[model samples]
Target: MTNVQGMIETCVQCGECVEVCPFYKATGNPSYGAMAKVGAARSLFAGEGLTEEGLKTLWLCTRCDRCVSTCPVGISVPDIVQSARAELRRRGQWPQKCSNIANAIIEHGSPMAAPPQDRITYLGKDHNVREKAEYLYVPGCWASVRLPEVARASFQLLTKAGLDITTLGEKERCCGLFLIDNGLMDEARELAEKNTLLLESTSAKTVITECPGCYDVYKRVYPALFREPNYEVIYIADILKDIVEHGNIEVKHSGRKVIYKDPCPLARRYDMTKAAREVLGHVAEVVEFEEHGAEAVCCGAPAGVKPLYPEVANELAGKLLKEASSKGVDQVGVGCPFCMHHMSGVQNGTEGPLRIRTPSQLMLESLASER
Candidate 1:
């Protein structure tokens, strides 16, 4: 039996995962917690049938791994949950939107359904993509399709540092974190293989990304699934500390108060709170939100939760926006494009008190100050 199955069978049912789960805490539903969901999956694998609602509960998980730290048995609940999701998918039962996302990624090379040409639209018609460069920037789906400025700002920052950086233009595919999180392993693997081939064809020795989801998948998930990527995978936030310290990039003191919203994958999964904080400190006065770091609140729609449960996602977003407002900051610096997208949705609709800006955008402001 697999280690995950061993852990599941040996689980003491101590309810430790319940206390740390944000979705379970927010919805107050046992099905949303890791303990109940894993037990349900265990029963199904043991030849017991679950109701349709029981199956839906598995897809409801965000795969945050917050429960892993609290489990005395050291069970990786998220892995078990993903295994359950794959079983459900095999039975022709899965979230419709998630399935569509997988199809979109397979058909269009992106989950956003954007065309290949659109990926390079932000680069303008006159810009060129180098065939051989030292760095290759993969601007994931959100940044390349939905938020072009974030991609633009990231490109500008890297170029300003005198690095020989180039983007893949249309060849770069979605990093497939969305599929991996949803238990679409086969789809994720296929996409990752295609991306890996394209990535290796380039002369770049390093690949940089601004999206935390993409960064996490490349740095952590891909290596476990396939051979390590030929080039290094780096999060832009991780490089900012070195770039700023060496005088490669200049960030003027704005004297403005800004609080950083740590992306869940960065803080809880990868422990990147310090790196994100260092990047923010260079641009503005860093302030703390009420709940921060590992304990920070989940931004309502971290993965596909927004499409699966819009009301719940918005509720979490509203609550987080209120928390940011009380901090009395001029703006909130978000490292993840996923979080920034939803937070901006809340900000735009209600014209909320505090503004939401990407850390790269804030850095761009510092660069603009020179003019």
Candidate 2:
């Protein structure tokens, strides 16, 4: 129902974007490509309904923005995908699974489909630590519920550094990036209001998070929505750097060699890979793997692209594991929890010559050794 003619006009329908899209490359499909899908999505503005074939085409895109980065004309493909999904939802033609996830986020303050009662289990028996803290650690939904180990490491390292950090008891809400990804703009805004109030109650100056999605939303979206002076959002990697720079944490390598898996947010867009390197460099012998930096491999977790395009996701992750494994390293460090989780599964011990670690684990180990 929404018109996308203005946005769609930006795409010149050039075929250059298809060659770089991992989804198109692995599936050999055009529906997910920049030109074809961008063109198809444009028709909806005229009230041309989405057919079964057209739905498959729109769903094929991973929405990773590889095309947007490569496009000479500045057409944003991911925004188009989001608009397409929103239009479908408007027409009552979107996927039920999409709303199911959104429904859980609205009802339970998280997208993990988990009970709200266990949200603060990551506090880890340190009652005095959280109650009298200066930092509030929001591990985000996926990491707090699904990826507990990485969440644990991020906390232990921070706590061990002697910073008083705390989290809400059963009151933390989803940071709402996923909702925005699904084009549920109103819900995303609502979740932000709730989380902003929660942060204000805690009065913590800094929020250390394990998930980049959470960091992106809290730092960028929360301010725009709330439009007030509030707590700062810091990624786990940056926090590690802070601890190291202030002489609060130290890492001993024991001769461990590591290859960095830069989250696309940090490596390409924000250019924070150097800080990530220094954080890990103090602890381990650090090395750069090929396809890192702006060209780094994606964790293939978000965008729901993993579900519909498993083979393509697997291919992208598989290639990274295979390449890193061939490098004869001791460890592969990933900053994003989703990246750490997906890459860890594919490693399977034998798939790589190295083990994958959350960056926080190494920092925690360093803190433990120093003590």
Candidate 3:
């Protein structure tokens, strides 16, 4: 369990973060939000016990870091949630997906449990992929297995830009952030070692990935866990930002005024908001939302909250849709596939014009500027 003593002291039960909480606003349940969770964690350290509801509360958060960014004292909700999750996991209250995912990652190299040979299915072999490339594309299991099309435009653009990029085929495994997030530190470490070994064998100087979860894990978590590292794993946002800033890639998208949905981990956790906008700036009439940047609300992805509480997740999307639609932006550009998957689809009860799109898709119709 995480030591709540420090964070508890930091959080004076200030209700400042209540407005920023997606869950709290959705469920009308304070305990599900940051301040309430902080109080519950503090109580536990003060000899109060965790109940079923309290444990479930920790699981309901998407770990989007909105609360922490909004908190005046910098109390980390994810760190606290992780601590509680680890404690719950120790006590065997972990969701079935935890063991299921961990086992899959351990054996199959990623949580998808598909054979490692299938990773190549995300992108086809038709392209002239090189052995010594500038960037290595490591799409996580979700992107590789379920959402291959999201990164297709990126691959097309990269090829057009003459990047000698290569993929790991079946060799690329999980970056292991999921395991680490749920407290499987040792397993995450092992996966990191495997990934680092594979990356070391490649001539790629930097890594570009479409998944923010994988991006965060590869760039941040692995180095912290493994203690040894090589190769700079970068988010596609950063890479694209460079390509645009350096005049390597040209963009000329100008159909609809769009808003970028900053996935929590992608925006706040990885600090890629400005760079992402800068890359897409040339192509898109990117409208800035009031709650953007680190303060950007979760589209109810990540942290596995959608599965735990569907209504709350829906309400979150509803609320966010209203917020974005109020600003008169029709299209919402998402960087993470998970965000796109959750936010873009038509919710059964909602009626709004908030269409979801991945940046790669947005860039597809936009003509590349003269290189």
Candidate 4:
């Protein structure tokens, strides 16, 4: 059990967290507030248990850690909520959506519950997949299943730059971020060990991923759960930034103006807020959100919130789109595939007023224009 008593004892209940919590701001539910979540976590920690409502409150959190930044005492509400969720899992009281996704990842190696064979279909028959390489590109479940275009663009950009990159293809499994988010530590650890072994077998010294969730797990969570990875884990944005800056490939400037939406994991967790901007700046005129970088607002699709609370997720994503529209940009360029998926879903269509695209896709557009 993760002890959060120290965190709970430090809270002064100043309510700073409520002002920044997207869940609380969107739903206006006091129970969904960060302070109330700490209280629920306390109850669960003390073995008093939580009501169904309290459990729902815990799950409502996206773990964006905005509350942590606001708390004067530096109380991490996300950590407390994660601990509370572990208690719920122990009692078999976790929500059905969590259970379904967990089972899909464990049984089928993806949250989509699709067969492993479905993972490689997007690569096309003529795709070249090396058996061993120096860099392994992991598109993650979202890129592999939900948004293949992101994967295609990223892979194409890397190859165009003449880097030695290969993918796991059908042998890849979920990075187990959902398990960690939902407090299924044991299952998450199993996945960490499996993925680490598979990655080591490829003799790849670096693992490059297009998904922020995958990068977070491979770079941060996996090491903490077990040992540090032998290979370095990097985000595709960093690679794209290098490729654009070095002039390895000619890219014409795009006339489109874009607002960059920073993914929480890359911005707040990893302190990586510049790479995507540098890449996007080369191809398009990049704009900023009112709150960006470490303080950027979340897209509200992470963890199990989108699957469990669709309305709240939509409400949160809508906030970003409305803000982008006010900025009068041509589109929103996101560094994370999950953000692209959620924001694009809420935007409704590719030809919609507010467009959502990855940095790689935008760069690909620039490359095509030069041709």
Give the top-scoring candidate (lDDT). 4
Alpha carbon lDDT at 346, candidate 1: 70
Q: What is the TM-score of each candidate against the true structure?
A: 0.94, 0.89, 0.89, 0.96
Better of 1 and 4 by TM-score: 4
For TM-score, the strongest prediction is 4
Task: Report the error of model 2 at residue 88, Å.
Answer: 1.1
Candidate 2, which ten residues in sequence have the lowest lDDT sum?
124-133
The parts of candidate 1 lying over 4 Å away from their true place are: none
Model 2, stretches more than 4 Å misplaced? 1-4, 28-30, 49-53, 126-133, 348-353, 367-371
lDDT of 1: 0.81
Residue-level lDDT of model 3, residues 1-371, one tens digit each, is 43556777878777988767878777787778778777666655565777777766777777777787678887887787777676667767678866787788888777668887566665776654456676788777767766677767777667667787887776778777667767677777878777877876777887888889888887788778775556787787777777766777667757668888786787777577877677667676788777788788788756666666666787787777777788788887777877776765534356675667777666666764322
Residue 128 Cα positional deviation in candidate 1, in Å, after optimal superposition: 0.9
lDDT of each: 0.81, 0.72, 0.73, 0.86
lDDT of 1 by residue, 13-113 (tens): 99988856767766778777779878878877886888765675676667776778888878888888878777777888777887888788778878778
Error of 1 at 368 (Å): 1.1
Clashing pairs in 1: none
Kindly list the per-residue Cα lDDT of model 4 for residues 1-371, writing each as its tens digit.
Answer: 33488988788878888868888777888778888898888888788958877777898888887778788888889888888888788888878888999999999999989777777766878986788999999999988888888888888889889989899998999999888887888999999999999898888998999898899999989998988888999999998888877888777778889999998988888799999998888888999999899889889888899999988989988888988998889689998888888898988933458768998998898888887
- Which order, best to worst by TM-score? 4, 1, 2, 3
Question: Could you arrange the candidates by lDDT from highest to lowest?
Answer: 4, 1, 3, 2
Candidate 1, run of 10 with poorest lDDT: 52-61
